[model samples]
Target chain A: MTTRTVAASKSGKLLNKLFPYLLLAPAFILVIVLNYIPIGESVLRSLYDWRGGSRATFVGLANFKELFQDMAFHISMKNMIKLLVFQLVVILTVPLLAAEYIFRLKNHPVLQNAFRVLFVLPMVVPRIVTVLIWQFIYDGDVGLLNGILKGLGLVSLARPWLDDPRLALYAIMFVGFPWVSGVATLIYLAGLENVESTVWDSCELDGARGLRRVFAIDIPLIFAQLRTMAVLTVIEVIGGYMFVDILVLTGGGPGWATMVPGLNLYENAFKFSRMGYACAMGLTLSLIALFITLLNMSLFGKKVDE
Target chain B: MRIRREDLIRLLVLGFLAVLTIAPFVITLFISFKTEAQFIRNPFGLSLPLHWSNYATAWAEVRKYLFNSIFACSIACVGALTTATLAAYAFARFSFWLDKFLFYVLMFLIMLPPIMSLVPRFLMVKRLGLLNTYGGLILPFMSGSQVTAMFILRSFFSGINESIFDAAQLDGASEGQILVRIVLPLSAPVLWTLAIMNIMTSWNNILWPLITLSSRELYPVTVGLMFFQGQYAIQRGPLMAGYIISSIPLVLLFMFASKSFIRGLSSGAVKM
Candidate 1:
């Protein structure tokens, strides 16, 4: 009886040690197969001249060499940079302003909640639908912008907003105009809410109110949220649904005006079947994203720590 | 009592911004109800005799896409939540060898942007014989959503009072039972928030399904809407109606669970 009880306790201890591994196995296995392994394959395949087949010939650095000289790739990179700049500026400022406006109405909790709900409501609309609606708005004829322009008799200014090479990228950027109706605003509002009441009291003692208080206290307090938004914005510009938007709207259109690297990579891999070259492009893009993410982290992260 | 001038100004600014934000949807609603002739006469204004038939035309085209989207997103959300919850509970409740290392390994993936691996992932799916199928769409979405769900759930689980878990353990409950009974019921709010967010994401996703499924019959609403727009390019009324039709599921979801939805969005920002 004594020997059996000891053996049972030993087995129970062993099971306790193994239980956590069993629990984590499903998640770890899925990510490894679906995410990490593919990432590894991307790196390896970048060096091989492989199509969508079993056979692959080693072609070290050739794909990367070709990528550097590709004019379309250069154009896409330049356009992506332009977009990154535009998005960074707009995302940082516009959402902050919108959140600030909502944060000021905190005393009226009902109105505050109403505004919060209203701001986040548009997010329910699918992104593709949003893009398509903008496509209609940018239509040369019978479009909302043009219709309004014609109504106001500004006919000269009402050309095809998306068809123009000079305007297409900008027009795409302008889709979510007054861009406060996103989760970024809510995140900022949440950050503002966490600011201690004593800070507000001190700001009031200093006679800092309105925009003055915002500059003095609120912005400083929400620096971490700003950093988070900035990092996410960078990652998004580099690799987000901008490609889908461009694909559906312009297809890189009238002379590669709105071409971005993600769309360029997609076209290479799927459309043109330049699999190796696409892999190389993917590596370069990921490296660029990583570099920027690290840079943003070090820059703002240190500030926040200090 | 007279309202303060500053408060009045603030209210006006908020109202104006709100109107500008919602203007597109409001215009789409108006356009969806107008006849082509009425639209040509006045594109921006609401016209008489609202053509409800436009919805019928849209519904016929949109229903298949809606069904596919609902089917795939539902599976992905449920799958993600299950795997992520188990993993989160493990990480929170137990400390084993490689615990921190494995957690960080999973966390590292959050930085690897999905676009970077898009080509290889496509090839991988093709190799697995999942191309042109719902598995191709649902599996990646489940994997992709795990990081955020795990991150959120793990933190929430860690915050629960340890005494409850201890009590359950002392009663001779297995770890699985403790998880299903104690942890899950306690974390319902977070799970609900994560589900809504995951569904919203998978529903909006376009690029993956666009590439994977060449079959028109299997297209999700986002991809299908693109084709629908092309087919009905000239028919503005029905096209606008289709866009509105596609938005109904999520909008209804928002109406019923607005608080959870809002919490999901805000907590989603805490990913970093």
Candidate 2:
């Protein structure tokens, strides 16, 4: 009402308007600089032949051209395609089935909690430790897999798992045996839990039993989870070098059987000092991810109920 | 207490699946306690003369890296939790022009695989003279987990009854005061949740440090253990022992917080 109070109220309004930006600037700014800029910077860096700061010549797309011709790159792309196809099929079905079983435990909260904990348990183990344990299990002399095989009197079948290129990549895949019952299971189970009991009762009245119930009722209900799991699995494979496993287990060989582009990028940038080339690989990977994300957005759409 | 035949069958099948999932870890634990000679000779079965000393040697080998892990993860937890809490409070409470846009931008970053940005980030750090230091390791981790923490914390902060803030404002509390004295005090559970998560993640992180840090001095327990394994590949007993030691902290954390962790993840998914 008074002049001083009015001046104070005006300043307070300005402060109220500015306060959110002040609060957001710290972390929002950090995330932008660290995450968003790097993507654009990677594209820019890919255009140059930056040989470890010794010589950075802007060669434009030449690195990408070289990437296409590079045999290792080709091998990595092939293996990635193989991994993606294999993961897509397995990741979708196995977890959903696991969730279906877990869903049946709706009557038993304690049992359900215990199993849920157990399912996501392995996730908490540092990925390195889990990968290394599998490494030991694949060791030639005293590895558990071979040891178990021999104990079962399959002496001829027991061989150096990691030592064989053909088996090494596949061996790594099976490390988390029945890997289905992890976070994916939890997601699907949550989706299943959200379904109306009336829906199930009507299906039961109609005698929509077993697989028919699942195919007709369950799958459609958990469709969002299915799509999400697919996108997440593909993106993770493309980005998660799990190459550390290769580094410890087989080092990408008997040959380049397990080589993935993610690892290739690491080796080029750090080991070989081919920063520009690695940047090119990084950009290609981002573009692939972006393509998949856009495709998922279109397929899954912006709404959940839909 | 009578079980239906169908329920009994489900229980049995679930138990079997659980065994199949857990057998390897139990077997590895059994192996870690064995002498190397015993492991090689009596490979699949438990034997006499358990070699518990393998843990001692493994612990000694990795103790330095353990400290480094603790240091880096703690720094990361503090830095990340602080930034995320502030940003999350703003997102939850404020209606700036860019709030929705910034929120989606953060969401977009969430879907991006960090490895896409790996090269440029490494270069950015190196150019800024942070490579091979804790700063390089901690900075990326802070960014990597920011969106997730923000998402979780924003939901929590937004759920706080608005009357508390209104009352606090009437009592002459500033925005900073409301955040620190009011919102943050009520947010301990979520803050601790994010703290534990960030610690677990940064502790397990390997790829970024693997690329950035060339020196052993900066190696967190994860990368250091990898080097230790590579160096002593033939020492299976010690390596297995080391793996067990390294995993114990995280496994213990998981056992305690699996409920909250699963809830957080599932809720986050539903929100998305």
lDDT per residue (tens digit) for residues A88-112 in model 2: 8877887787788878866777787
Chain A only: TM-score per candidate: 0.96, 0.94
TM-score result, candidate 1:
0.96
Two-chain DockQ for model 1? 0.63
Could you report the DockQ of all the candidates, in the order they appear? 0.63, 0.58
Q: How would you encode candidate 2's per-residue C-alpha lDDT over B16-85 as one tens digit per residue?
A: 8787887777777777778768876766567677788989989999888988888888888888888888
For model 1, the superposed segments whose C-alpha errors exceed 4 Å read A302-306, B264-271
Q: What is candidate 1's CAPRI-style docking category based on DockQ? A: medium
Instruction: Kindly report which residue stretches of model 2 are placed more than 4 angstroms away from their true locations once superposed.
Output: A1-3, A303-306, B159-173, B177-193, B266-271
What digit string (tens of lDDT, one per residue) describes model 1 on residues B116-233? 8888999999999999999999999999998889988998888899899889989999888988888888877678778888998899888899899999999999999988998998
Q: Note the residue pairs that clash in candidate 1.
A: none
Cα lDDT tens digits for candidate 1, A1-306 = 999999999998898898999989999889998999999999999999988688888999999999999999999999999999998998899889888878787556777788888888888888888889888889897688988888799999999988999999999888878888886898898888777888888888889988777887888988878887787788888985587788888988768999999999988998898888898999898899888877876766563112
What lDDT is reached at residue B211 by model 1? 90
Model 2 reaches what TM-score against the true structure?
0.93
